[model samples]
Target chain A: MTRVRVDLNISLDGFATTADQTPDNPFGQDWGRLTTAYVGTRTFRERVLHDTSGAGTTGVDDEYAQRYFEAVGAEIMGAGMFGLHEHGDDPEWKGWWEDEPPFRVPVFILTHTPRPSIEMKGGTVFHFVEASPEEALARAVAVADGGDVRIGGGPSTVREFLRAGLVDDLHVAITPILLGQGIRLWDDLRGLEAGYDVTTEAAPSGITHITFRRESRG
Target chain B: MTRVRVDLNISLDGFATTADQTPDNPFGQDWGRLTTAYVGTRTFRERVLHDTSGAGTTGVDDEYAQRYFEAVGAEIMGAGMFGLHEHGDDPEWKGWWEDEPPFRVPVFILTHTPRPSIEMKGGTVFHFVEASPEEALARAVAVADGGDVRIGGGPSTVREFLRAGLVDDLHVAITPILLGQGIRLWDDLRGLEAGYDVTTEAAPSGITHITFRRESRG
Candidate 1:
């Protein structure tokens, strides 16, 4: 079985983004520490950002970044993270990460509408799949081979997997910012009975890098 | 006019609660720096938990907490925050809060099912209203008099308010933790064209307390 992993940045008060989310402030400054964590390490930054210069040398954050990037094979995300036309009828904008996206592998997006697969300059290919989480994971896992399957999300997509007990590994870079009013990641899931073992926990800079493995399912 | 506010604790990666979200890890962690924020200052701690000591101190967190307890004449929350149900149909669980909840005001819970209002010890009355956000906010605001209406949510409730532009002010206390694979607050709200101004930012602790005022719709 292919291990499924999740990695994302979060604020201290547990907000992924502000309530009135706009292009200007996406994750809000609450996730500043995570952003700092990303930029702080030269090797991790270079690998993810396509500017490969440093490697092997170890730092606190660099280890986390390396582990996260290495564990995942392909990425699966929700369309909301890709664009924004969630409520209203008008569908105009794409995503904040325009043109050249960050991911090097093929990225699958979960949505109701259908859009053409956009292939960016790098190995980033955005495939809009209107299937369920199982199908998406199947495709991602197949592509990942022996590597891990990663769920890239704003929150709902993650919950979809967690509710089904499909996730295996988890990595969260917790920043120390709070958006007193915005979207929250944990509101929809309240009664879930999943147990996670904290395999790794390190406070690099200010953000804590914690990794968890899902325990036995009843 | 009466002011309304929301004071929530979140992890650095923006998870208000952990992924597994059980009664044991209610707020998560035995006592990390984040959990300590809830009972942090001796004076404020006494007032909230014991209802004494923290009468008139005004640190950033104190000011923030005061904003919630003082200005918030009434509040609106979700079923997830209210309680943990065994079955979606089960009616035993009321909420994770103790006999006397933290908020000593009128709290209107937005639920799909109908239930009678449960008035607690302090001045807290939980009115389970099976209405829309607009309806809930209207009722809450009506009860608020001049006080601002605080949207105490898990995430969906806040998103509804943001989509409706009914919220006036938002204060987020971004913590430094993350449940990367749970529900996300900003999942379906990626493309809304809303704007806000960062009015105040104070880092009393490592948790930078920030306030974002939504742009006027006029």
Candidate 2:
């Protein structure tokens, strides 16, 4: 069974994304500021930025950033993450990523209006699905083969999976910045820590990485 | 120049106290569970519990717990923290603490109905005052005698001081327990991190200690 995992960058006030997000400023004023710790990592530079210059920090933040891409086969993300909401009806909007997206596996994009699957270069394929979290997870799990299914998020998508108790492990990098108003990750998910064994590690980049792994009932 | 400091034990969801708080259950259902890290520390056991046996954990948690009383002279707390709400209209109500409270200086209780000052044993004195955060801080600072003024909290009072930006340093211990509903300490205080330099340290006891020190502007 492929375990479901989620990794999110959240503010100290629990906001995963800012309220001022728009087409022009998708992540709002604090987007770049909040993700600086991750984006400055060597793994993120190579994987996400597709930079071959061999730049970026290599420490605790990089260690956690490297783990984010490890042991994950397929991914399930919301429409917002795919930039479908912002660039409505724009066929040109493949995704925020370049020609070769980082997943290197089948990626399921959950949207209300489903579109035909788009297979990109470098072993990355986008499958648009209009299904519930359970259905979506099954589809992603099937595509995942033997590896884990990662729940790529914009906060709401992760909240849905978490509320359904589908997530087996969660990694939250709490940035020191405060977005104040945005979509909260912890709303309505009270007593969430009871089912999980939690551990926290503070990185030198001023970000606190909190990991929660589900405890086996047996 | 007496710096105002605050120390609170909060849940992962940012709750300091639960809704079911009462005289019988001071900290509600999660009191003992949430405060286990602090109460189990050698500093807390010695200062607050008045135990001189030198028992309890001696590590990161204890180091942070010890700072709760270091370099501080006076304390300012809400009426709810003093148990005035539960035991109302009783002049005989001295306080929940015994004769020698942990605080060895003047402690101001912010209440609507002010009462006569009661000087306790062991250099501790309780004074009831109907004052705002600034007014109360002024009084506490004066009595602090150049030491810091500690904002002892029940959440709402701390919220007021935080909103006013009177706190110079804040230490919050994020416990592993999750209390779903309660008075949140981070509510209405958005963009609070912008004014301070924040750092996080995780302890072996599974509690993450977050510190925020106000940045000095020359």
DockQ of the candidate models in sequence: 0.05, 0.69
lDDT (0 to 1) per candidate? 0.63, 0.87
Interface RMSD values for all candidates:
9.6, 1.4
Q: Which ten residues in a row have the lowest lDDT in candidate 2 chain B?
A: B209-218
Off by over 4 Å in 2: A22-26, A215-218, B20-26, B215-218
Q: lDDT by residue for model 1 over A1-218, one digit each (tens)?
A: 56887776664444555454357976544344336766667765576555666633357767777777775668898877776455324444445656666666788888887677777766777787889998988888778756677898867788788777788776666554444555555554433323665533435355555556775331
**DockQ, prediction 1:** 0.05
| Best candidate (score: DockQ) | 2
* Candidate 2 structure quality by residue, lDDT tens digits, B80-156: 99989987589988888888889888999999999899999888899999998989988898889888899999899
lDDT for model 2, on a 0 to 1 scale? 0.87
Fnat per predicted structure, each in turn: 0.04, 0.68
